[model samples]
Target chain A: MTRASISSPKPALVAAAAALSTICLALAPFVVREGDLRLMIEIFAVFTFAQSWNFLAGYVGLMSFGQQLFIGLGAYFVFLISGKAGINPFLLLPLSFVFCAAFAAVCAPFVFRLRDAYFAISIWVIAEVVRMFISQKDWLGSVSGLPLVATRGMDRTVVANTTFYFVAALALISVFGLYALSRSRMGLALAAVRDNEGSAAAVGINVWWTRFFGFVLGSGLAGIAGATYYMSVFHVEPGGAFDPNWMVIMLFIVIIGGVGTIEGPIIGTTIYFLFRAWFAGTGNLYLMLLGAAAVVTMLVAPKGIWGVLRSRLGFELFGTRRLGPTNHRSSP
Target chain B: MPPVLQADRLSRRFGQIVVADELSFSVDHGQCLGIIGPNGAGKTSVFNMLAGVIRAQSGHILLNGADVTTKAQHERTRLGIGRTYQVPQPFGQLTAFENVLTAASFGGGRRGQDAADHAASILDRTGLSKRSDMPAGALPLLDRKRLELARALALSPRLLLLDEIAGGLTEAEVNVLVDLIAAIKPTLAIVWIEHVTHAVSAVADNVVAINFGKKIAEGTPAAVMADAAVQEVYMGAVMDVAAVG
Candidate 1:
């Protein structure tokens, strides 16, 4: 057999892009204003959420409308551990993630039983049930919610900056982690499963387990984002934590940015925040505009904005290379 | 030696329509068995059962003498049963190389560089090396068929199941596929379900005919094709002129 070399065409460019983003985010604490830090945190939170959703819907073809389940669970976990148990709020991130992962694992067998639209709705129903259950729990302070009491004694600037850094790290991890995954064997399996489950099975991919993994990972990330959000805000409520609007915004970002590509979520989230900032005073009109924009993006470029730009420019910053001869030789 | 695959009294029904009834068949190691039947004759159903895509109400599917009737489709593939669909379904967003590489790694149980090497060879053999970088969904029909075959072959299976791979192909393209299959047949057992009689006749050592979920004829390709019951089943059916002539 002839030797074949498979290398990404623009590895340097991808590396430079990664380095640049890291540098900018790392220096954000010194350069960014306190108010702007809050906005940056919001961007990071939504970025992580969109990344999680994109992993599920884009790579696994598991369209979910109840990702808020994990987000809420993360917040509640932080509250239960830090707010009630008095653990340091910063140390609660891992606990929140693990709890959300366990919750997802338990939900998998039941949710996997449903397909497509039913699966989406079933997940939403599960989130609602969780919210309602949490609302009635007296230890969680009932529907009134709980505050991050652990952060009460800390300096306001120190708490805000630390939380800001955590959120930024999460955003980086979500993007780079997904990028690395999309280049792995498991990532190939994910794409296979997404494209055609029947064909994926025929090729020996465990379709159920692959989707389950995606579900768990996506949920865990969403949980972390949720925990960070509530930690920064110093409070968590069932209503705010489990809001379905989280999923709505995530879907809009993913759809407008690009559904299946790594670049989509970042681009989508950036566009989303820009629009939100520009229309901050418009209230409900802002949401309407976002919805309209998503509809227009879908109709105009179903692959999303990143997808459109990638196709038109013929460049992929994080695209995985095909594993075969790069030099195209004519067939025999 | 144990047969590569055996289906014992396999039966299935879709409400009122019986797709397979007591369908028993076996193919030895390095043998090529061709299955021919008219439309809705349960030919694809048998392939589905063998591939574990559909369950049989009552039957045993054995791979190398081990019962696999309870196995899931992916498990069946891992157990050395690789198959292609009638309508080829390749991963649309992935490049052809990625599609085959996925199977080579996951189905063939290779990893890392080994999987890449295996996938590369398969792509070259399938005449898709030049088109390996193209998204599979963009491939022309003939190339798509080749991709299906390449993906199935990536499993490095003990038994290969091909469904209508020669359909929607020019005579020359069919010939190319026939030669490809023939080249690889020496090392693997093959069960080919095809409406293209000439393609089947050219490559299959044995032929089986079925209609209404029952095996109507089985023997050497020439004998089965000439069987009276086989002719009767094909007569008045649209496939009759194409299959029998």
Candidate 2:
């Protein structure tokens, strides 16, 4: 039997790009202004959320429109624990993730019964149910919501810089985690499941288990982003926390950047931020423009910007494609 | 010594159409059972039941003495049953290597380097090694069928169920496939449902003929093909022309 070269190509390029981004983003708080730092924090939060959604919709073929369920739960979990239980806000991140994951596990069996369009709507309905329940809870301040009181005593600069660094770290972790997952054994099963569930089953992939993992992991990441965002903002409300617009924005980013590839979310989020900055004063018109852009991207480049570039230019930054000689003459 | 797969009293119907009526058969270890029928004879339904893709109204499916009637498709796969669809179903965006690797790792119970090596070998065996890096969606029909067989083989199944894999192949391509199946027959059992008579007869040890969900003839390939009942069912159906060609 002849051995094949299975190692990913361009390891150096991936490493260098990772290092450069880490260094530049790590020093942003010191070099960038406070207003810029705030924007950066928002970008990082959205990046994390978009990355999670991309993983679910792009990789696992579960197009959930109810990601707000986790975001709201994460922010609420932070509020309940830190505001009532007196835990530090920063320390509540893991608790928030656990809460969202457990919630997702409970929801999976019911939501999985619906497929394609119904599945997407069922998640939105579940999120609405959760939102209504939270709105009616008196201890959680009902519809008014609660403030993240734990950070009230911290120094302003310290809080801002720490939150900035935390968001940056979370963004990096989410990307790296998903990239690593796409290279693992479970990742291969997920790709198969995404492509064709019937064939995936023929190949011994437990479709339910693979989808459950994606749902839980995606929810947990969304929760983390929510918790971190609320921690920095110092406030949380059901309306803002569980807004359906979060799902729309995520879809836009993943679709515009390129679904199913690691670089897609990153590139999509960057372009989204640029568009947001340009239309900052346009209110709903900004959203309309984004929607139109998404439509155009889908029409012209159905695979998204990164997908077109990958095929046309052989430009792969994350090494998702298999690399080797296309001929049998070269033996490994 | 024992049969690798046994379907006892399997019966299913869709509304007024009976897909399988008291269908029963057994495939012994290393045996090749060819199921020949005209279109709509429910050959694919039988394959579906054995592979756990569909449920039979009242039947017992045993694999190596264990009752697996209620097992899900993936569980049956893990229990050593693998199947190919009548139409090839490759992971469209994934590379051919990735597609086979999924089967080797998940279905065959191999891991890491073992799965990669096994996938590479299967691709080589299927004459798909050069096209391994190409996306499965980009492959032509013949390569797609080859990928389907390669993916099934990666499962390392003791019992393989093939559904019309040779339907679209040319005679020369069918011969190549027959030779490949013949080469693998000594190691595991295969239950092939084919509209192509010559291809099935060349590889299968025994042939069973069915019409309207009921078995009409069973014996060696020659005897079954020559059975009057089998000939009558094929008279109006296109099987006569298929058999001749």
Candidate 3:
């Protein structure tokens, strides 16, 4: 039986569900008020960052504890270009991608040399090194950080900028786009390599090339996230830019949502933000509760929240494109 | 004549313990060669050297009489060498068809719909037509073996290397595997390193036996199986199978 004819919900039904989600988001600002609107935009930023992290760790079998290195650097690059150099902030976004990609290219050989846990720890060390170096920069505001704008009056447009930025974030997220990209030929190669590197090489795959491309692409996305996140926050510093809390948030999202599929990040980010709102007044108890919940979820649903839902529904919300019918037979 | 693939004086060492030593062998075009050996006799090392995953300590490897000793694994694959592992390894998350599609696209240099068709046909030939859309990890033992064959075949290899694919299968499964190997014989040369004596004998045109990284016998399967030294190395196990003769 082909997936196309597998008695799934009608396209209209799926479209209606998507339309409802869009409508909900569109009306959220009016119903939830300004503070909640700003919070929701922040949540979208977190989702973008987490999904990129999920792409690297979940699909590539890479655990990068130092993703903040790129995210922080991208934030700083945009802050420097826009705040100090007086360039339009939007122009500085793509420039951050280029800079982060170049850095990954230079660092690929060195970082790729390390295996497993060593690779994870090495990346974390690299991030700390970068953070410390930036912390010592007097002109860049050192530990105190820098204002994202030179004057108070120009910054009055922050609300509109944040709103427009959220729209752009949602557009770029485009779950279907990510799903299509991840199901392409390159994605298959990456999945094979991730499953078994030695076998992948034996079958004529360039394992290194597959992994390096995934790493670089993932880093670029993280950088883009950092740039946009800085605009949302309206400031940049070593502490805020290199916040390990963002890493914690991302890991929780991927772990709680589902690491490998596109839906995981979306589902994860929504659940995470909801929990945050529910427990905001609990102080350290909130963080402790999140930690306990993450551990419990991982233990109970190791594939993450999306995996649970997919299993229950017998659906692949995120999957490859269909060109024609598939001839699937049961093995005897 | 220049052989289609030639490995001269190939050697491998793991810090003083030699796995392969000064081994020289050649596979001519459209020739099926069987390699038999005791456990850990380094038959897979030869395959690894030919496929370019591990470099030989000192040797010249020529593909179609052109040196490819230092080429990368993917480059060697593009040049028409494909291999299956002793233990079949398929992408657990991908469907069997998707796994083969990757081989067609990246290894065989095809693209899009053509690559998909190439993969599907390869799967059909390998008896995996029914399980194409099933996740590879969910497939049974025999299907997993077929997935490995399908993956290698999807590359449209000029030289196909099989590594102990029948090692753990039942006698019946071995027979099915042998038939499949025989069916593909006309189009591609095969180098099958197998532990299952009968299966190798059933398919190989010629057989070479190795002991301690050195060739012990080379000839027809029946002749090699009957050789005193070849029988001696099997440590009396072949004596029981001798009744089949």
Off by more than 4 A, model 1: A328-332, B238-245
* TM-score: the better of candidates 2 and 3: 2
Interface RMSD of 3: 4.9
Each candidate: chain B TM-score: 0.96, 0.96, 0.94
Instruction: Quote the positional error of residue A223 for candidate 2 in Å.
Output: 1.0
Per-residue lDDT tens digits for candidate 1, residues A127-204, read: 999999989988877899887789899899999898988899888888777877888888888889999999999999
TM-score of chain A of 3: 0.86
Which candidate ranks first by lDDT, i.e. highest? Answer: 1
Q: What is the DockQ of each candidate?
A: 0.72, 0.65, 0.48
How far off is residue A18 in model 3, in Å?
8.2
lDDT of 2 at A166: 83
Evaluated at residue A156, the lDDT of candidate 3 is 47
**Candidate 1 docking class:** medium
So what's the TM-score on candidate 3?
Answer: 0.92
Off by over 4 Å in 2: A323-332, B240-245
> Clashes in model 2: which pairs?
none
The sequence of per-residue lDDT tens digits that candidate 2 reaches over residues A19-127 is 8889998888889999889988999999999998888999899998899888999999988888888888788888888989999999999989999999999989999
Q: What is the Cα-based lDDT of residue B108 in candidate 2?
A: 99
lDDT of each: 0.88, 0.87, 0.78
Query: Which is the winner by lDDT between candidate 1 and candidate 3?
Result: 1
**lDDT of each residue in B19-69, candidate 3, tens digit only:** 778877777777888888878888888778888878988979888889999
> Quality of candidate 2's docking, in CAPRI categories?
medium
